[model samples]
Target: MKRLFFQLLLVSDLNVKDKLFKSAIAIFIRLTYFVSDIAKEKAPQLAANFDKNDLKSVETVFKSGLPTPDEYAREKVKALASNFDHSELKHVEPQVKTNVAVIEEQ
Candidate 1:
């Protein structure tokens, strides 16, 4: 069937050795995007000031060994908690609490 052939094509496109390489490449791309988005959000002034050269520099740094957004977020939160009296852990707490309450009620 046409569907089966397409599936076969997808699978055969990558051998075992290349599969790992492709997966790593995919993960890197995803992490780069995540880091870029977080950087943009948290440092809007810096992001706004970024020229084409700046973007290229960021891309180069990210491709080398930069941490992903999730890693950056964790470090940033820890740093803020340690340095400041007031800490904000607002995003996940509410969703987790709501999910627990729903499960208990059910």
Candidate 2:
């Protein structure tokens, strides 16, 4: 049963590192939803932790959503080119470099 659950949680489309990150995000979202539902049901006061705007954002994501990866990448490139700030690049470059290094190491 444990093995089956683990397998079910795995997303085979992603390579190992991506798979792990995706799995973690997926688990976090599931846990968040579960806790939110419990709070809404049993302890209404706890639901205040997730504000109206946060709930609306989640609902919009589920209903409307972000673009496809290709579209998102193209838009990101356009935004980066237009905004083109060295300060932002400093923040972004390290994360990209770290992710690339980790993937390569794996």
Highest TM-score, which number? Answer: 1
As a TM-score, model 2 comes out at 0.26
State each model's C-alpha RMSD to the native.
Answer: 24.0, 24.9
Off by over 4 Å in 2: 1-17, 44-106
For model 1, the stretches where C-alpha displacement exceeds 4 angstroms are 1-17, 45-106
Give the whole-model CA lDDT for all candidates, comma-separated.
0.72, 0.74
Q: Give model 1's TM-score versus the native structure.
A: 0.27
Evaluate model 1: give its lDDT. Answer: 0.72
Error of 2 at 44 (Å): 5.5
Per-residue accuracy of model 1 over 1-106 as CA lDDT, tens digit each? 3455445446646544577655665566567678878887889787678689877988898877978899999999999878964334576678889999999999
Residue pairs whose backbone atoms clash in candidate 2: none
lDDT of 2 at 73: 97
